[model samples]
Target: MNNTALLKPETARDEVYAAPLKDLNPAQPALFQANTMFSIFERLRAEDPVHYTPESDFGAFWSVTKYKDIMAVDTNHEVFSSEGGITIGDQPMEEGPLPMFIAMDPPKHDIQRKTVTPAVSPMNLARLEPLIRERAGKILDGLPIGEEFDWVDKVSMELTAMTLATLFGIPQEDRRKLTYWSDVVTAAPGQGLIDTLDQKFEIFVEYHAYFTELWNQRVNADPQPDLISMLAHGEATRNMEPREYFGNVVLLTVGGNDTTRNTISGSVLALNQNPDQYKKLRENPDLIPSMVSETIRWQTPLAHMRRRALQDIELGGKQIKKGDKVVMWYVSGNRDDEVIENPNDYIIDRPRVRNHLSFGFGIHRCVGNRLAELQLKVIWEEILKRFPTVEVAGEPKRSYSTFVRGYERLPVIIPSRL
Candidate 1:
């Protein structure tokens, strides 16, 4: 529990079992920041699949860690509503609750989601693929080979920021602003991005102003292929309230941002940790698609999705009351042994690699799920063509949040590019 001496996975394994299941608080951002929460999740999955804590940093919430149980809660949108919010600790916006589709229920969720769906549609992503590959190649090629560099910042953040900007039809030059705003939205106090809630709200004010200007510009011009134009002209979303529009834009921005960025970082670390998988991938570059899916499952980038129970329901022999916070730990569920064979092992050729819960299930499943995979696929393909291996030069600094399970900095070296 000492912050001075960070918890190693081995130590975390023993530490988690030492505490009583009821006393364990799975929502601690420190546990995630240290990357030692998996042992805690493993213990919970075996002992208490539907575990609850009376009090914690994010207030009392339920942890649904099993694959089947998570699927139940995720799929039954009617029973477990996202209306409360997606993250366990839902921070209220200064402007009040942003009415985004990912957090809305029923007919309303469908309407708002439909409006922006085209921005990331298959047709749209197909058009974007060449650009993603070009950007990925450029990003990778620009890396200082044989020298240690932060992959999360250099490759992950930069590439995702560009893609996010392209998706929104914003200037690629201003992409880092998108990256900064996305990080601020999810960062908590002392996380290194921003310190206080007030700072976060202030950043959003600027973010809202910029996006609102884009909306105004697009609303007047003929409809364009960009997301802002889509929202500016969509039948249901055109007359949206300011907060409502901001909510949807944030949803798309962060949704497009986090999942791909983190997973890209994770894939490198995973391949290094599992050298056999790396060998397999190197020998058969055709496995890049499978590797991407496996990495998504292995990383489970967005750790958990939270929902407020709409009605009382029995799950895993425990009663979940209406209004209770229910969290589907996708990170844990992906490692559940019941559904996945050798769940903890990172196998690039694992069968049904896409069967994992990283991208929630049912109505609220990640809208940009395919786009995320496509980005990873293209990036990895470019990586394979260039580097023999991206060696992890040092330990990674994991993201400091329970919600955004990703790396902040990953020191890696591309010894020599081919």
Candidate 2:
């Protein structure tokens, strides 16, 4: 019942963490810069691959920096539970508890994941490729020529929202709401347009109302081939509680919005920054698959995922007690020198590109990874077909939160109709 007890230990750890934070500067204006947190990650990965930071805004957490450590923890899910929650810091929600598959450990996690796996299978995604491509084409067709535009708003957000709209069978007009709800839900403590606590609840209330309507409609309507229909009609899903259903919707909405949106915006930014790689991609469009993987790696959009130690464990030479919070720094691990060669450079044809931890690793890896790639590849191909040049017209800005790395605004100029 005492929050102060929690505060004392964390404050002590802060003194230790801050000492090193002062010596090392890993912040990069382009790659990572909003806060000096990432700089600390880069420092620890170099000095101590598996380091513990006693103090953080989220309380004390162990920062897992190496690629191997992250994979080891992720694969050994039995010892490290996802059920305590997947967030590193304290969550803002006052709801009793949120139901998300990402927050459940095995058994429950396995069962929950199975409920929606059918909808995202490789075969299902292949069947939807043509539809994704058609949507990508329409998105690119609407962009203005020779004038600077915010690519994040116009292209990246639109592509992701449209693809999700198709997947959920959400009407076109309501698609933007997906982006809104996702921002409010995931908006780290002080980020985004609406910063007040009450404002955050209002947004969630609206999303709940919308999803409630959709759920009621889907329950009565003929079974369609979309995700909503799949969840509604599936026998497994019938066992889910109302909160669980709400959790799935929230997960799907956030998953659909942030990851894909960043990949698209990050891809264009990477291409512009590395013209040589962009030239290679433009010439050999076949390399788009490798490029997509590289872009995910280079961007490392979803920054970190938190895991709770279910039992006492020794990881990377450190002993972790049960209930210890472990934060996997995907952004830092993606650039681990040991796992990735010349990790800082953007290599379009890097052979081991698929080895990156962008989609994460092990059982809880991103469920919509294949779909995200399909959408990115389609959008890139369409852009190449229509425009020969799409260059940054101004400096791009990044989101403030450490969780999701993405461009809040990316100014770009495209030559007249290629």
Q: For each candidate in the order shown, give its overall lDDT on alpha carbons.
A: 0.88, 0.80
Q: Give a tens-digit lDDT track for model 1, residues 1-418.
A: 2231256766777777777777766787888887888887888899999998878767888999999999999999889999957999876675557778899998989988888888878898899999999999898889998889999999999999999988888998999998888888888866687878888888998999999999999999999988999999999889989888988888888898988999999999999999998999999999999999999999988999999988889999999998999999999999989899999899999888889998888999888899999999999899999989999999999888888988888999889978
After the best TM-score superposition of candidate 2, give how far the Cα of residue 155 lies from its true spot, in angstroms: 0.7
The pairs that clash in candidate 1 are: none
Off by over 4 Å in 1: 1-8
- The C-alpha stretches of model 2 lying farther than 4 A from their native spots are 1-38
TM-score of each: 0.97, 0.91
Best by TM-score: 1
How far in Å is the alpha carbon of 26 misplaced in model 1? 0.8
lDDT of 2 by residue, 199-315 (tens): 888878888888878878998999887777777877778557877788889989889889999889999989999999999998999999999999999898888888899888998
